[model samples]
Target: MSSPLKRSLSTTGRSISPPPLQRKIPRLTEHVSSTREPSVDQLRIFSWNVNGVGPLLQKQLSFSADSLSPLRTFLKRHHWPQFLCLQEVKISSKDTATQRRLQAAANQSAAGDEPSYTIEFSLPRDKYNATGFGGKVHGVATLIRDDFGSRLRATRRPDWDLEGRVLVHELDMGLVVINGYWVNGTSNPYRDPETGQVVGTRHDHKLRFHQWMLDEALRLERSGLHVILIGDMNIARARIDGHPNLRTSPVQHVKNRADFNAKFFTYENGLSAVDVFRHKHGNRQKYTYHPRGRNWGESCDRVDLIVVSRSLVDPLDAVAETDILDNALDRGHSDHVPLWVALDMSIFSAKAAQSGSD
Candidate 1:
């Protein structure tokens, strides 16, 4: 059954619940790991759609500094990842006061001095975005461990970055991490502001976003960076990625999937960055999203993914582990579960460095 807090959002032309008008948006902290930790050489990355950070953190608009936020606890239990990317943050960039409170809270720790993570957020611009009474409707955030934060640089394409959906973080290791929340063509008609007439849906916007993402990834790879594009792509690239069966729109849906293949997947002579999860776990009947009020296998899809440049693959890392964490599902935190990928950073050793330099 769906949780009471479920917000309606459409995927594959199917309507899910919408977000609440107001909720607390909390910042995250970390503690010593309670679970086994990844080795020093292992670079673990995690992506999750929290739906809203406030509910997951058990925080309220009052801004009480709670030490044991569910998110902080979850990080401890899972053995804190080096980089954590989040989607559908739903916090308005227009709400600077709330954002200030969040940053202030994030700056605090048990020691009351040192920081835990260096967080960056991409939120919808007020001038032109989907804003409700509360503010912006969608956003994406990336949190890098304090120690590694210095090694990172962030960028976004202005064309689609205004919506706060795409953020590209470049590391010195010739690795570029593109964290995105792809647009979902809700198919709901909206009145055109200029024409003052009811017009088409967001289908074109969705397609353009996907195309921009593809172009950017390819562009980075050509510049000698190994790309790791991860997030809620919202495109079930294949029937295997979706449970039961993928919903279809003979014209739009089919073209969307085909364009995804022709641009990103290797099968269609596209970019070299392959879906790391599928490369490691082929044809596995697993999923990263399960809509509320729906059975597990009835309508779930592995929309979340970690696609990596082939050059980053090697025996040591060989994509050590790729998992769709069900713990989030078990907790009923979000309709979507978290996806994690473990890769050995050593893959960018002297030999790889020399090759790139050449």
Candidate 2:
């Protein structure tokens, strides 16, 4: 296999100044006319576990200004939703240059005109202490088209926001979009040296985090706002989600499988969400993550996902166009491919107007 793209931002040893924020928020009602009837507008939303943002932007910059890189090409192709949610960005708060580079890249337009998107990052606080690639901080980031930024109100949950795991944004259309990166619970079991009995494990923490996400989703639903939950959930919902040939220890496999099923499919009190992609394409055997050369009996799985509440499911389903960017895989950009969906935004606009009139 060809070498993956380099992961360093300052490999050339040149000090670069941070780029100024250039996003301009427009008026929320500009897109809607008072006399015109609300019509369905195709809104495309894309999600990816970028693994790291610095290296990804470095790869994009390697291309000449006249030429489009894979990253740029992917972003430019889908013109519908214009909103993006990214996970496992692995960027730290202190890395201002890298952050600016990412912001510029995401906002850049193909026509060399003013940027179309505004960017926000929920990066980890301490680069030196976080656990990941070389103790680098990893968190989630979001990008919204500049037109929608005027209607967007973003806040981090007081209890869950500090760790850079969740970002909540409410649009003036009465819709809420959440971007999240759940903890990967893969640590080895801790055992007592003398008795050889398993003492503890990180698996429990992972399960608890999953529970927290579910509870938060429910809370948002009760508040009467339409919700779109998208991110790298890090849990395979069923046996079909993973490669059949890959094998884990029997005990470990059973516990993880059970947890994933209950969290995603078990509906409590008639409140449950639907996985948009899976609902549209059932048992298709598509995997989002392909492990690179480290096979302990695991090769591929579908960990990344996009799910929406039941209230919005019918409308989303009517106009949903979902796909995994298979061609972008193995290009050394990331282990996971991008998953995207296009939905009709007219539904939300109509609902918002009706509520306002009441």
Best model number under lDDT: 1
Question: Which digits, one per residue and each the tens of the lDDT, describe model 2 over residues 125-215?
Answer: 4322243444344478888877667878665643644447777878766577788877555444533334556666546545766677777
Which lDDT tens digits does candidate 1 get at residues 14-131?
4434553343432323432243668777778989876766565443223345564455545555666878888887778776665554444444333444337666888876343455
Query: What lDDT score belongs to each candidate, Candidate 1 first?
Result: 0.67, 0.60
Candidate 1 has what TM-score?
Answer: 0.81
Per-model TM-score versus the true fold? 0.81, 0.76
| lDDT value, residue 274 of candidate 2 | 78
Worst lDDT run of 10 residues, candidate 1, spans 1-10
Question: How well does candidate 2 score on lDDT at residue 14?
Answer: 14
